[model samples]
Target chain A: MKTINKFKMQLCAKSTNESFARASVGAFIAQLDPTIEEISDIKTAVSEAVTNCIVHAYKEQNGDIYITVKIFENNKVKIIIRDKGCGIVDIKKAMEPLYTTGGSERAGLGFAVMESFTDKLRVISKVGKGTTVTLFKEIKSK
Target chain B: MECKLNMTDDTLTAELDGEIDHHTAKNVREQIDLEIDTQTPKTLILDFSDITFMDSSGIGLIMGRYKKIKSIGGKVKIKNPSPNTYRVLKLAGMDRLAKIEREE
Candidate 1:
């Protein structure tokens, strides 16, 4: 697919880096001239996806998290978050709101939040392999 | 994230600043929980006048605190949430669990 602009980053799957991941994505997408609300939506979705990798993917160890942002000519933004850690056993159940494997402390709203904030969301995972999440958003033109 | 807790005879008001994400949510929860556990106040108010950003993690933080305070026969209130933060909070159905006070 042809993209007008693209940026990729690789960060360790650490709890402390979740904000950094979101901030980086937000900064990259700013060039699209998105509204403040649009930016907030993107940042929130990125945070959820990155936090999932840190908390669930690498339960006992650290792994690499790959983030790719692509801006198409149509002013659409696509974000891909990938982690090569313990893949999800059940993607269906995992996307359900309030259904979390991370226990009481986790509200299990990560996937739901991402889905709500973006125009499209796709999750693909394989046990013992990895999980990849793709998100799409149509940036409103000013 | 910056958290400041003010304790009255029966109320605990927490002034939170900066962004609230998964990275900062843990610390925010712990700080507030420590005060809630120690004082067992009759009410807990979260002041968000200075909160610049928040996500679903913020929702979880508030919900968790609501559960804790309710268990102790207390209530939770949110004050001075920015328009964006308030929208997110409402979308999470937090208004049903706690009182969301508009800035005066």
Candidate 2:
């Protein structure tokens, strides 16, 4: 795949940074001329991944979130969100909707939403080290 | 994020404005819960007309509120969610918990 454009950012793993991550990614993805719905899907996917870093990865403590966005041939966009925090015990179980470990304010639909909104979703984890989520989507805009 | 709340006919309507994300949800939850606890209304309406962005965190917000309102014998109504937001709500099966109205 030929890379057209790419950028990387490192942000604090905090709830406040979630919107910043979404907006920054949304802006970068805009160059592909994605439809409103397409952009929303990407933004939502980014938010979910970043929020996971804050809530589950760092546990609201303090860490760094790394995001890399890539634009490839055929208007395909790829995003990687990573954190060096507590990884999931069971990827399959954590991906289940409403099976949250983040307590009352979480619905455990992060991975599900990413799967539904994007063309491909991938998760990699090591229990004591970190987790990385990659999201891919092709923009077919009007 | 900002929420405008009103109570009429025992219905407490919260007009949620701005993006609903993990960063802002905590404050929004506190505001709505405070009103729900005080008024104890028969209905809790969440107006999303002004919400510009939402993620799964929005689902968590709604689900938590639904449980809170349901325990008090009240119901929840989600109003004017953008099509994108509605898709998320439907994906999570939230329509079964709250009555969602489109563009009213």
Candidate 3:
């Protein structure tokens, strides 16, 4: 039996909406019987990616953050976080652990954390265009 | 975010209540550090019993505290962490950095 679900939302690229995005994704994913640890891991990864889009993708001003969630029948969830703002100049440096552009007292471990939590992570960015982060993870079946 | 501090002999316990994310990390760091510096306790206990939600920024906070307490030859431990928080800590390799004890 294969079931599929898709969700989309346009959020403000602000710190406040970051929470909203994370919570929304968390609640949506909670529909599956994911382990408690798995749920937290996904939430944290989603938060980091969304926060990067909120803070760095639109450094100059607030913009729109689009989050698309797709849940497959195999219980694999894919998250696509998109931003229509300033995109990353160097994708490699951005993905590196401890690589942070803002002096906001962060650990610069956002992408690193996201990579660790999900089964797959991909980032597509174009300067002056936008960035989209695709993350995927399969929930453990009970 | 509201942070309450309690001290007992050699242990400094911090009750962190509210959402711990990028926006609240600055003030939370200051308050936690202030308590550690002022009390100079031999062990620091982070009571996350009341925390509702946390993000990667929370990892930064915990890591910063670990560094602070380690520099002073003090140990760090967590108590009553919610299931969600426990997961975040595990993903960040925080369990190895500090000891965790379940609270009943």
Leading candidate by TM-score: 2
Q: Candidate 1: which stretches are off by over 4 Å?
A: none
Over A67-142, each residue of candidate 3 has an lDDT whose tens digit, in order, gives 9999998899999999988999999998877677866466677898889889999999999999999999999987
Query: Per-residue lDDT tens digits of candidate 2, residues B1-104?
Result: 99998999899999999999988998989999999999999999999999999999999999999999999999999999999999999999998889999974
Question: What are the candidates' individual DockQ scores?
Answer: 0.68, 0.91, 0.41
Fnat, 2 decimals, each candidate: 0.56, 0.91, 0.37
- Model 3, position A33: C-alpha lDDT score: 83
Give the Cα error of residue B62 in candidate 2, in Å.
0.9
Stretches of candidate 3 above 4 Å error?
Answer: A1-3, B69-75, B80-87, B95-97, B102-104
- Each model's TM-score? 0.96, 0.98, 0.81
Question: For each candidate, how many residue pairs have backbone atoms clashing (under 3 Å)?
Answer: 0, 0, 0
lDDT of 2 at B14: 97
> Which tens-of-lDDT digit does each residue in A21-140 have in candidate 1?
998999999998999999999998999899899889988377999999999988999999999999999999999988888867777888888988999999999999999999999998
Ranking by DockQ: 2, 1, 3
lDDT of 2 by residue, A1-142 (tens): 9999998999999788899999999999999888899999999999999999999989999999999999999898999999999998999999987889999889899999999999999999999899999999999857
Question: After best superposition, candidate 2 residue A133: deviation in angstroms?
Answer: 0.4
Model 3 root-mean-square deviation:
3.1
> What residue pairs are clashing in model 3?
none
As for candidate 2, its clashing pairs are: none
Give one digit per residue, the lDDT tens place, for model 3 in B1-104: 78888999999988889878887777878988998888899998888888877777887888888888899999999888887777677766788999988776
